[model samples]
Structures are given as C-alpha cells and as structure tokens.
Target: MTEKLNRFGMGASFVPAETLNEIDLGPLKQLVGEWESVVLTQTDEKGVSKPLASGWNVISVPGVPKFTFEVIPYKENLKFSTVAVHAGNRGPVLNGTQFDQEIFGLFYEQQIVSMCDTDFCNGRGFGKDTVIHAETGLLLYVSNINGGYNIARLGTIPHGNAILALGKSAQANNPGTDFFDVISALGVNLDGSIPAMLGYNDQISGIPQFAEFQQVHPNTFLKSTLDTIIGSGSVTDMTVLSMSTSHPDATGGILNIPFIQSNVTATSMDATFWIENISGGSEPEILQYSQTINLVFPSTGTVTPIIWPHITISTLKRMQPQPETNEPLTLSAQAQSNTPGVPQL
Candidate 1:
C-alpha cells in the first residue's frame, strides 16, 4: 500500500489528517454500482463504424482490490449484460453488460474506484473535490453530486479538501460558532490507484511469416522445430510437410514458405532465415538461398483466430462424462450355465 501523508512541520497549525473516517461513503459506494458508456471507435468488417455501449459493475472486497471492466454485446432493445473478473492476485468478481448496439466494436474496457476523507457543508465549502493520482501518471477528480447538485450543500464532506470548506461554511452560517467546537472530520488513505481503461486501435495490424517443409521421419524433430520457431517469437506462420527424404534432390525435399495473417508483430529478424541443415544427414550441407527478405504489412487490419470444426471436436472429448455408469454383461448367466439334463444324457 502507498503512504498517505507527508511529515508535518513543528509549527504547522493544519496537519495532514486521515479523512476516510470522518464522512459517510455509503452514497458514493452505491453510486458506482453500475455504469454505462458508448464508445465511438468500434467498426465492422466492411469498414463501417458504429457506436458500442459497455456496462460495468463495481464491488469492494477485503484488502486492496484491482477493479475489473467487462464488455457486453447489446441484446434486444439495446441492453448489455456481462461480468469482469478482477485481474489482481485475488479480488471480488465484477460484472458488466452492454445492451446498446450503438457501441459494440469497442474492445478495451476498465473499472475505476475512488476514496475521500472530508466533508463539505452543503456545497458551500472549499474541500469539494477529491483528487487522486494514478501510478500511470493519470489524475482523477471525484466529487459528491446529489440530484444534480453538489453534496457540499448538505454539509457532506468525506475525506478530501471539500471537508474543510464545508466546516468553514457551517461556521459562517452560525454566528458565535467556535471553529474547533463545531468542526467534525475524518480521514482515510485509500490503498489503490485509479483504473486506466484502454481500447484497441483499428489502424494497427501484423502479418506472420512461416516456413513449411517435408519430413523424412515421423519423429518429434519437426514438431520440436516448429515449437522452437514459435517460441523464438519471430516466426508467425508454420506448416509441416508429410514426406520422407534426406537429400534436397528428392521430390519430397520441396520446401514451401507462406505468409500468414497475424495480429502479433515480429520481435526480431531471425525468423526470416531458414534452418540450413534440417535433414541432419551425414555430411549435412546448408541450403543456399538467393535472397532473404522480411515482408511487411501492406494494409491495416485485424486477424482473429479461425475456429475449425476438428479443433472443437477434440476439445469436447477432453471433458469428463456426466452421470457415468458401468458396462453391463453382454451374455446372460443362465444361458452360459451347463447342467446334466435328460437331453444330454
């Protein structure tokens, strides 16, 4: 948790004080329960842009919790319903919904939380704003608004500057009021930072370059090489050839290189080079290339994973069977039994 206060000077009259304990946060907590917004950057495949509305559900849990934001699609009549799980080590589950089709293309969503320490005297005080600084260099301003009016008018001040203003305003309203006698205050040092919401950029894109070659044996060598290429973070495309050959002279030695559409950017130029001696035969020789080149993306677009039917079927088989039962006997016991009968005699 971050420290809440700075050291005070010996002669200072007003010291940095705790603000959370002074004011009631019930109303503020209630106000953050559900929030909705429409994002204007969402677009479709046809390059058509549309507004996408998203919803959020906030909750406070034990310890410092990282809030979550969820994206929900619009259902009938433009309403949304979705949930966001906190990304921290352990936090409460937050849910959200988006029923407004006007904002469906928005991908990035976030949740924010705030804490205050003082009270405002019915909007008449100076301590009306709660200012919070985020680790990402973002500043947040939170204020109590009631029925479209600032809550300072109601003598409400939770934990920030507004609390002092409310106290002064209250003193001015009543003459002969002792500042120390009438002023009530509390302070709280909240431990978390404000959430920074982000969204996907439609203008950025990536393409993958892959190498495909035939194999001489059904060994793990091919698969291992494929894994190594991907793990290197440079190869974006891969294809395994089905053949057995050791020399480049064989028809099966043909290598096919293809470019795959990808959303990831290449981290290095190493992927552009092919394994010189893939066959690993006696007196192995490296394949000479005329030129090596790295392909760049010619246009901006996004690439989503294409779900194939075979992959889906394989995943379903991994799930455990429900309401399982043991196999029954195929033959009846009586039929298998032999007895000394008159016909046999």
Candidate 2:
C-alpha cells in the first residue's frame, strides 16, 4: 500500500491538488482558469496614442503581383481545465529493470475574434467581433525519461492541422531580458521586413488604424508590451515555457489533412509562453505567448514552394481563480475492483 501510494505520489500528507497548486502541473499551474486578451497603447507619428489590440496575427498568401500579406488584430479568450490526474507510461525492461513514467495534463480551449470590421488585403480577415479562430488541445507535464523533454503542447486547430511541440522550462527574475534574447535566438526577427518583401504594404491590409503594427515585425508589438509591464515593476518573477517541433532534442511535428497537405503544408511550429506573477494588483497573474507556424505552398512563378510564416501573439490576464477540485485522484475499493488482479489501490 505504501509503495503504491508513493509511486503515484499519494503520500500520507498528500491531499488533492487544486488548479493552482497541482504538483505535477509545475509551471503550467499558472495557466489554469480563464484568461482574456488585453489592449495596449501604440503611439503614432502624429503623436496621437491609439489602442493596440493585444492579439495580432500576420500571414502571407500567394497572389498576382506578389504574395498578399495580412495583419490582423484580435481579441482572445483562453481557458484551461485540469481534467486528468496521475497517468503513466511503462517503458521496456532492460537488465531486469523497467522504466515507468508519470504524467499530468490540462485541457485548454482558445477562441479568437477580429477586433475591427475593416477588410483585409485579398479579402482575408473577418469583420469586427467576428470569430476568427478556435483551437482545443492538451498541455502535458511529463516526468523525466532519460533526460528527455519534460513539457509538451498538443494542439488541434479546426483548420485541419494538428501540432505536437515538446521542450523544457525554467523560472526567471528578468523575463523582459530573457524574452528578448530568446525571440532573437529563435529566428523570430524583430526587424519587421517581411511585408515589403511580400509586396503588400500597410495600405493593402485595410486596417489603417493598425498600420504601425503592420510596418514592424509582429514581435515588436509583444516586446513593447513586455517593456511596459516590466518597466512598471509590477511583475516580480516569471516562468518561461518554450517548445518547438523542430528542436533537435525533441521529437514531434505537425500533421494536416489531405486537402491541406496538397495545397499548403504546415511544416513546423514553435511557441513560447510566459506566465508572470504580479504583486498587489487587481489581477495577480498574466499570460503571454508568441507562436509561429511555417506554411509551404507551390507558387506559379517559382519552382521552389513559397515559404510563408503565420505568427500570432497575445497578452492575457486571468479572469478568476480556478475552483478547487475535491478529488484529483479517487482511491476506492469499488474503483479498483473493476480491474482483475489489481490489489486494493
């Protein structure tokens, strides 16, 4: 009995873990509950400050004169639920010893909507307050297995694509500095030069109010938001979770349906999430993430498939604390009896 409980991390003093206090969730615990996107401020050349939607998406599509580039600002709602507790995978036996790993997971749903009704270049973006994106997935916390990845994100998009990205995590005191460093190192350039190369300028995107956001690298918007938060000294610590399907150390990639695979293939995906802790504020915590997806499609002029990037970034605040779950793991004789040869567990 003692061994079985300890194996499952149910010690004598162990009590049911709630949303924010789950031991297996690690840094992902901060993500539980509801989150809503924020609105930042952007200053124009005219010295007038305008509202900048916290959610921004930039993508390129094949077009006539050149590829049509699009910049869309949106609002998002992300919610996480702790649906599983105490799962495991049994490894192969070697030299009379087998490796058994423990795992925990949380279910997440993401909904995004356009912030403006303006039309986009080549008729892409939706109208104001229109639902633009919907996604559901699982975030897993895997116990170490021979120095392998400890965290992973499994995402499914209605657009006929599924993503499996794996990586690691760490805590940092200076998230602003760390975020900037990683953004640069990961090839997410802040130069904002892709629009011109694609041939569609700000005027073509149709949202004149967001022209400034379109002119620079989409990440610049995220950097500015971090600067303001860190500059205010409100955030004291942060947990950085970075994952990539293309990372050499990790194993996983993107998959698409037949229709999507034939026209445009989603080759890879990478994302970084910053879970920040704020002191003495109405909102005790905030979550920010930057994600990039590589899309490859055949173009008429070039023999080589055109490689375009789809990037999305957002800053969200926690709406409320997640209610405590009374029993994360149920230990009952009736439950154990269902399985044959299983002792009282």
Candidate 3:
C-alpha cells in the first residue's frame, strides 16, 4: 500500500538520493486529481511605504475544475510589434505583428504546468508557466504576461490587460492613492481600460464593467475557479521563487521594453492541507488543501516587478481508475467506463 503524506511547505531541506541524477516527486504524485478552492485572498506589502489596505478579495468556481497541472510540452513563443511606414513617415505607422514561437526553442519534454484560464487570466491578460527545478526541489514557474505580472498571476490581472501602459506607467501605491492604482485598474470598463476598481464604481455603476471580488453581478460573488496540487511533507519543504526573463512578448512590446536583457526569477508556493476525522471512522476520511501562489514577472527596463499572490482552497479526493482489462468486457461491464488516468501499459 502507498503511504499517505500528511503535509509539505517551505523550510524543508533536500536529502539527495543514492542515484546522482534521479529526483523524487514527493507528495506531488497525489496531486494528480481534481480540486476546488472555497476561499482565497491576494495581498501585498505596500503598507510599509504607504497606507495599509486590503488586496484582491476573490474566489474561484467549483465542480468544473478551473486550475489544472499535467505532464505537458514545455515551450515559449516570442512576439514583436512591427510597423509599416507611409511614403515619407519617419515614425513607423501600422503594418502587422510578428511572432517567434519558442524563441528560446526547447525540445518537447514533460514539465509541471499551470495556467489561469477560468474567469480571470485570459489573453493580453493571460497567465501560464512551466516550472523547472534542481535536484533539491527548488522551482521557478516562469511566465511573462503580454508580458507578465509576477505576484498576481494566479489571482487577478495586476495591471489589467493594458500591457502597453504597464511597461510605461509607474507602479501604484496605497489606499486609492496615486502610488498604487488597484482600484482604477480593476475599475476598467468591460473594454479593459480603467480608473481602476475604485474609480469604476464612482464613474460608472450598475454596469458589467464595474465589478469586484465581493460582487460579480447584482448579488453574486464572482469566484475564480481552481483545481490544483499541494506538496506533501512539512511546511518547511516549500518556498517561493520570484523571477524574470526577457523576450519581445514578455512586455507586450511596450515602449522601449528591454528588447534584450537578463532575467531574474522569484517564486514560492504557500500551502496547507488538513485531514478530517470522524468519531469512529477509518483513519481520517477526508483531506483538503489551501495554497497561495507567489509568481513574479521579469522586469522591464523601466517598469518594476509585477507580483501575483494567487490563492486557492480545494477539497481532495482520489479517483483511481480500474485496472486495464485485456479480455473484452461484457455488455453490462462496458456501460460504465473507468475514470481518466488509468494505467494502460
């Protein structure tokens, strides 16, 4: 029987295996299933420089898994904005956009992958990453938005979908001040532009464009769905890595974005798992987990790092597929198919 791991997080040390090159996946093996995040919050440390205030108060959808990870092909594409000049134009006019898929070309290989594709994190504002780690379990989930916003990648779009403005604009400060524009950024009209979330309510009310974590509609709380895996071991086993990289697409080809530069990385995972026990049941029957993701972006020549503190709460359940059958199934047996991920070989 497989031994169950109870917990895992930052501060744990790595013990090298006898095999020099082999790596153990740890509790991550049990993470290969569906889950749901019941509650979540994404915040930052802006108070030290300004006023103390709350951050994105959002949640995810349930049942229909919103977050997923798998053995996926690892690759990245690079895009550059091109322009067509008129007869005598010194400044370039419009032509079309050019893209280089896998600019840092990579061979097809399996990697732990995660992406924000539910209610939030979609195009121009999408978030996705392929993590790499040394033998010690240190990992970095690298990705650039149109470029990227590191901290909020898993929560809400930090600067919204305004990639052009992100690289050129300054970071916002505290509590509705000019320092940080959280409100105005979230307030953007459905069109994706904004005075931020705060200004959205003041300028336009009752419109779909004006929304927040508390209210997606008249009475509904717009929840962001999540299906994720948590590490199993001790709280000290896991940590965050904040990183950055350079590619034409990383900064959405924003003004003077470092067309070529060095990349730094920042990343870490905040997680908690619990087991519920009944008065007289079979060794604690239920397991659940809550995790917060800290993914930061590569900095542009002028822009500061974008941080995304993505969070999720999900219930855990094992869905073991029946053993593959060599013999043909009877009519009744064929009716109920086995769940996905069954061993076929």
Best by TM-score: 2
Off by over 4 Å in 3: 1-264, 278-284, 298-302, 324-345
Task: Encode model 1's per-residue lDDT on 1-345: one tens digit a residue.
Answer: 012111221221111113323433222211211122222134578999854212111111111122111111111111111111111112234465322211010011112111111231112111112111111110111132221211111111111111000100000221111111111011111222211223211111111010111111111222333333233333222111111112233221112123222311111110011212222222121111011011122122322221110000000001122332233212111111121110000
Error of 1 at 157 (Å): 23
Ranking by TM-score: 2, 3, 1
TM-score-best of 1 and 3 = 3
Name the regions of candidate 2 deviating beyond 4 angstroms: 1-23, 41-50, 176-178, 181-209, 214-216, 279-283, 322-345
lDDT by residue for model 2 (150-232), tens: 78888887667888889888898744434543232111122433422343343344553465564245667776676665565
Give the least accurate 10-residue stretch of model 1, judged by summed lDDT: 309-318
Residue-level lDDT for 93 in candidate 1: 44
Model 3, position 81: C-alpha lDDT score: 8
| Cα lDDT of model 3 by residue, 1-345, tens digit | 011111232122222222312322222222322222222333345534321111122211111121111111111111110110011112224466333211010111111122333333332122234121101111111222223432211111111211111111112121110111122111222233332323323312333321332222211221121111221211112112222222344432211113111221223343333332222322222234333333333222323333323343233233333343333212111111221211010
TM-score of each model, in listed order: 0.12, 0.75, 0.24
Global CA lDDT computed for model 1: 0.17
Q: Is candidate 1 or candidate 2 better by lDDT?
A: 2
Clashing pairs in 2: 117-128, 192-217
TM-score of 3: 0.24
